[model samples]
Target: MELLDFARGPAMEWAFAIFIIGVLWRLFGIFFLHHRRDLNEPRHGGAAPWWGAVKTVFSRMWPRREFRERNTYSTVLGYVSHIGLAIVVFGGAFHLLFIRDLFGVSWPALPTAFVYLSGVVALVAFIALLVRRITHPVLRLLSNFDDYFSWFVAVAPLVTGLMAVAHLGARYETLLAIHILSFQLLLVWFPFGKLMHAFLFVPARAVTGYVFTRRGAAT
Candidate 1:
């Protein structure tokens, strides 16, 4: 009860504050970066810049043709886990409640059983990803603390959340508290880590597409 109280009260407040501030800071930096003036006339036979920007954001979801075969398995599983996580976060009743409490938003939620199953699937995908990273030579060479810690934070909430739902390892309150704490850890690290890619990737890719379109090449 005490743990739950702390997690639901002070820790939640602090974590939410830090997450908001950190995300805004990173976004401000991205928007304020120096830009080179576009002096050249618009090139012919290229994608329209603004339309290309919007198009590339969705187009880049899949791997390029040249890299498709080599990375197909990883890419597919990544999407599975990503979609699962998205369902768990945005479609769960409890998650929607949290969002409603946080941002005054409201929406219909999927069945609890479905949300639980999605969490389980997402967790499994993350485990497979870790195993692949450990065994693949090139991936192992590139792996670092950021890679592992980000994985931990990403997976921790899922593991703890499942545990909470099942009432395993502790009383429900304690388990729930730990689950919330794990999520808070994720929130704290999100903006400073690879998780920022969730918010940054679309804009960055759009800008890349726009710039390339301006150069008369779109890839």
Candidate 2:
């Protein structure tokens, strides 16, 4: 179908181009920003800032003890969505095939059923997070258009891909085209949104940890 062709062709190419350029542009800006040297010497001896940075990145993966009670469910759902998305994207056979075709790299695929299960769980976990963002008093007060729009674009591909696979509500070709286009939407929005956090979170945590350690402050 012409629609499918366009979706798979120019739309995908343009979206991928925008994605790469935008992400590189942002990364270069961030990485090249001039950092003012700390004029003061480190306050804490044996703090080992580099080691602190590495440790903090891993440690921050889980909430601190005092915050665990209120954050447990939210944290669990976050991991569920993140892990599930990783599995579905990197381990699925079809996805791997796409990667192979695009970049000429190949890897072993997960079982099809497992990949589908991961996708379903990811969608559910992400939706739960979205609901919390909408209903939680502080979160809702702080939320803006970017938050909601990022969620929409991120979820669209997952929903459409599942629908396309299940042949729900449309012809196979049409559904496939919709799925691809939805993915392109995600690509186009990824670098310009909170979705950029996907790439920045690790560095952010590490940098914060290093700074806090050097100042002998609790993270």
Highest TM-score model number: 2
Residue pair clashes in candidate 1:
none
- lDDT (C-alpha, whole model) for all candidates: 0.91, 0.91
Q: Lowest lDDT 10-mer window, candidate 2?
A: 39-48
Candidate 1: tens digits of C-alpha lDDT, residues 123-192 = 8998999999999999999999999999999999989989989989989888899999999999999999
Which residue pairs show collisions in model 2?
Answer: none
Alpha carbon lDDT of residue 180, candidate 2? 89
Judge candidate 2 at residue 171 and give its lDDT.
Answer: 100
lDDT of 2 by residue, 17-70 (tens): 999999999999999999999876787666678878888999998999999999
Q: Each candidate: RMSD to true structure?
A: 1.4, 1.3
Alpha-carbon runs more than 4 Å astray in model 1: 38-41
Worst 10 residues of 1 by lDDT: 210-219
